[model samples]
Target: MRVAALWFPDWPVQAAKLECDDELQEPLVIAAQHRVVVCSQAARAAGIRRGMKVRHAQAAAPELTVIDANPDRDGRMFASLAGSLDDVAASVEVLRPGLVVADLKAAGAFHGGEDVALEMLVDAAARRGIDTLAGAADEIATAVIAARSGQVVPPGESAAYLARQPLAVLTAETALAADADTVKTLGQLGITTLGELAAIPPAAMTTRFGVHGAHIHRIAAAAPDRRVAPELPVADLAVAITPEDPIERVDAAAFAARALAASLHERLKEAGRNCVRLKVVAELETGQRVERVWRTREALTESATADRVRWQLDGWLTSGGAGAITSLILEPLELMAPDAVGELWADRASTDDARRVVERVQSQLGIDAVLQPRLIGGRGVAERIQLVPFGEAAPPVEEKTWPGAIPAPLPARLGGGIDHPASRVTLIDATGKPVIVTAEALLAGEPYALAWGDKKYLLTGWAGPWPVDEGWWASDANRHRVARLQAVGREGGPQGDVTGWLLVWSRRSWRVEAVY
Candidate 1:
């Protein structure tokens, strides 16, 4: 899959300059979450850098003009530029507001050669008063990295070209999907270049960092890239809306655009698919029609699709070439299946259906209303299972070898809480004496019976007292010295089924920790 990438440097700053003409000459910085996300050339010359605190950046450059980052505005402004690229290549994929990529093989053949094809793309962007740096390589990651340096890597030379790049390239906006923390961790481990990262065995990378590591390793090694999958849209999936009132103002157009976007996305989700290319069509009151096609490297979410629609409308209404819009239509020009991989025997369709239901419920209630279980590094069963928001990504588990963690076949159910009445229990010996865990991590006596709430049961079998001594460096309130044992019990009062219980002895008290 030979690919080409076109990058617009300082895009956020340029987008800001387009919004306000006065800031073009000033040392401008775009701030998000009180930090400088991107700084203009002038700001950089004044010693202002990206990721610096906004206050400190302003202090360093007293003449700095700070503009709050607006991603919608950036996408809105870049819509026209992205549209221009369509004239050069038929399959343009926008990675973000500033970065666009496309398959170069077809375009190269039509334009005489790959170099000519790349130059045509740069010329297309330059015609719109935008500076573009273009690069082509055998893979998408290498192409993006090459674009940053304005270098067109020769065929079959992607691996060697990427080897000379710094590890920081992994965290570029258009490069591999690696996070900053992962790159930083690799650098601290003495792997400061792509060559060093690629030299590691793929198995070792996978063992250390799981799937993410394997993906990065493959890209660095210049393995065969996955074929670009593009789907043709079914005409029946298109959605349209005719507002009761003709929309004239940008705010009103934005409202109508959002409604159309949501309706289109719901239809796409119902079909168990995602959109790759979106077509926005507007009908003016004077019977004039205008439309544009927006493409994405990944699936387009509801908000992203809405931003494109809203931006298109804003451009038309604000450009003074069109009147109030009488009707609007959104069409999915291309579609793709969900990217998540499922088990071989798993019902992927049913799983996707259930996820959509959960997302719908979360949208109605709140993001925190639906929680999913994630396993983390911890000694106790309850501490290991962390509940996070349903759609959020699970945090990386750093500690791979937990010395005192409970062994597998983990308990099926955890007790309510430490102080809950249901979690309290009593373990007694044949002499009616309570069984305790000694400081030496030994049991006082063999448990003969168990008293849980209002039921009594005879102990049939039991396992060892797995000792856990954690947080010893902290205060007394934070320290934990407990021993857990798995026991099987039969009901004494009624001839009922045998039940497995996970009991813990801590603070001189017996409590039920989990149920198997």
Candidate 2:
């Protein structure tokens, strides 16, 4: 039941250093909520220490480079090392950003002996440019302290070793057992050390702090159950299909992929696993094999998984390859527990199956064929409303303030009806003169009527001459001096009802492209 713990001092700072491409010469510190968590070696030398206020640390080291602490980044970066450590420790459990606990006896036995195993673990971590310290004891709690303090305790000596240590050694265990205030309470009670706290009857402690206090008592006792628990096993989900006939076209194969994806996703849901990577393998009728991998930052829903498969098949078939998919296989490469993030980082809840139908349609039609309008920074309604491929991340929409950009209540279509059929239209003033917007963002006349083809509608209300002047400095630039307006009007067709429309003034004329 020996426990082994690996501790990476200042792991957040270490992870940040690894992530940043530039050489960081300045004293650096990772902070969260104005509290210092980890600081660089130079920052340490400059008297910037952990537990110090961020302001105090900055004051200590004026040249300090303060980095916001991100636990997700630390965990994500460490996940890349899981495969490498699998051989070293068969059952490794990640405790936090800097801490890992494993079965000491098993890990040591795998690499000859305990000392050799610790040495191997250190060497392996060093090779990856991660500084790690190893410590082993009969109990997990003792092992954590040993690793943190660079000490190793003999078998059955964990309790004695922990007795001299302060209660602060539990800093990295997360909020599982006790809160930080509990430590202060213990010290205030004259239980200044682990030995003093351990001496208290477990029953009395439970009466005071409930289960958490009892947990602390057990850890202090260094019992056998203190052994590290292995991480939950990920479910391996794979789906394969063989159609009655060899599917030659991407359109036909997509249906099969969609069915298989749905089945795989349902199985994954039942098993409580979410997939992030899909490996699509197709066996062509000509006996040639095609395989492609697609990965997403977020876990893929059933439809997204199908899209990746379809996209892969589309590329493979459209390349003039002499193949149709006789057999298709879908494999999930990575699976994560839905509750692992708890929606703090990502939504843990499963999406509705109805959304899957819409996404599937977008997949079948091709990314370009289906587009979603995004409000990017531009002057006119048409210019601001750019159509992007459905399901793709919207391009930088509000990256910078395009000062006079039209505000929301956005239009669904643009002039000549971009997303719909085009029609001839005329916009006129109350005096029957055509409405126009001057270069100085002044309207020539108030709009009173709108004429489209054979039907005409009366303008109900109007607002704004919001102006935007863009690209005026460059000679070759397509300079635009545009004004925007919002209006409400009823259509000439039956069941006519007043609806909002986002209108724009461009090329000395006014036009509306949408009914909001």
Indicate which candidate wins on lDDT: 1
lDDT of all predictions: 0.79, 0.67
lDDT of 1 by residue, 353-453 (tens): 45655654553345688899998768778988899998785757786787867788988998987667788899999999988999899989988999998
Off by over 4 Å in 1: 21-23, 127-130, 226-229, 232-238, 242-249, 268-300, 312-516
lDDT of 2 at 238: 81
Query: How does residue 166 of candidate 2 score in lDDT?
Result: 74
Clash number for each model:
0, 0
- How well is each residue in 469-490 modelled by candidate 2, as lDDT tens digits? 6778866457856566787767
- TM match of model 1 to true structure: 0.60
Model 2: per-residue Cα lDDT at residue 177:
36
lDDT of 1 at 55: 92
